[model samples]
Target: MDPKEIIARRVAKELSDGDLVNLGIGLPTLVANFIDPKIDVYLQSENGLIGLGPIPEKGQEDKNLTNAGGQYVTLKQGGMYFDSATSFGIIRGGHVNVTVLGALEVDSEGSLASWIIPKKLVPGMGGAMDLVVGAKKVIVATTHTNKGNPKIKTQCSLPLTAYKEVDLIVTELAVIEVKEDGLHLIERHPDTTIEEIINQTDAPLKYTNVKPMEVKS
Candidate 1:
């Protein structure tokens, strides 16, 4: 399986049956594709969707239906839509159970920096700030490195979306839990070594009940 698929599949395991999950754009959006069919997971799109389904088939996309990222999507049975105000209300009101987002940088303190890069032209900071603060749990789904540069850093040099808001970090190489002390390595990918993961991460990490990650075929 692809590395991103491996990460997404592993993240899918973090969901509970009744979770109202908000999946951020980019890599985080892929989590919907791997959720267990029997579980009652409600996917929430910040743009105004309540019961999001997986990506639509090639020709079956509803032009009017899209996620916060503007990707065409299908709706589950009882799906509903509302205005942006109500959508943010759901986020700000703390109704979301878990939120999975992609990060540009994460620190040992569990801080996330994903909204904007220094001087680059980019869109507004979407709902990340609100989601991180409002969601009961926050999970960051990102690769360990970007173009061979470690993204898990000793300190984020970029602007942070939230301070000490991340709960977990899932990468292609490992699953790390953010604790009061620091980032903890709880699960390692079956194909990688601890040394490799350590070498690829710039931040310090602690180990606890470390086990191999379960990747579904």
Candidate 2:
């Protein structure tokens, strides 16, 4: 299975009924594909709308409405539209229960590096800054490493989306909780070893009553 699918499924399990969630543009966007059909998680978009549904079929695509990633999506029955600027009010006001975010790097303190990569060309910071701070719980879903170097590090060097705002992080081999001091290892994938996780990460990590993360086939 794809690593993203694993992360998506795991993120799905964190949801409760009636959550207002914002899925960051890339890999995090796949969370919509994994949510249980029975659970009604209210999806929100920063571009002035809430109650977003899943993507529509090719022919059903609508040019007017789409997610931040520009993918066409459906809407819930009572969903409404407003000005994009006002949407930040909902984000900063703490109405969202959880946010699934994609990150370039996450530091021991939960600082995120998503907006810029100084030397390399990067796009806008988007709503990451607001979601990290405003959402009650922040969940980061990304690969353990990029180019074989760990993306979860001791301190973030790229940039900051928000400091110490992240709650949990899910990588291909590990599931960690971001804390004030550093990461607390909660679980490891079946074939993964603690040594392997440490060797790949650029930062030090701590263990927190850890056990293996299991999945039901």
Tens-digit lDDT string for candidate 2 (158-191):
8788888989998878889987778888888877
Question: Could you tell me which residue pairs clash in candidate 1?
Answer: none
Residue pairs with backbone overlap in model 2: none
lDDT of 1 by residue, 48-93 (tens): 9999987888999888999988989888899999999998899989
Worst 10 residues of 1 by lDDT: 117-126
Best by lDDT: 1
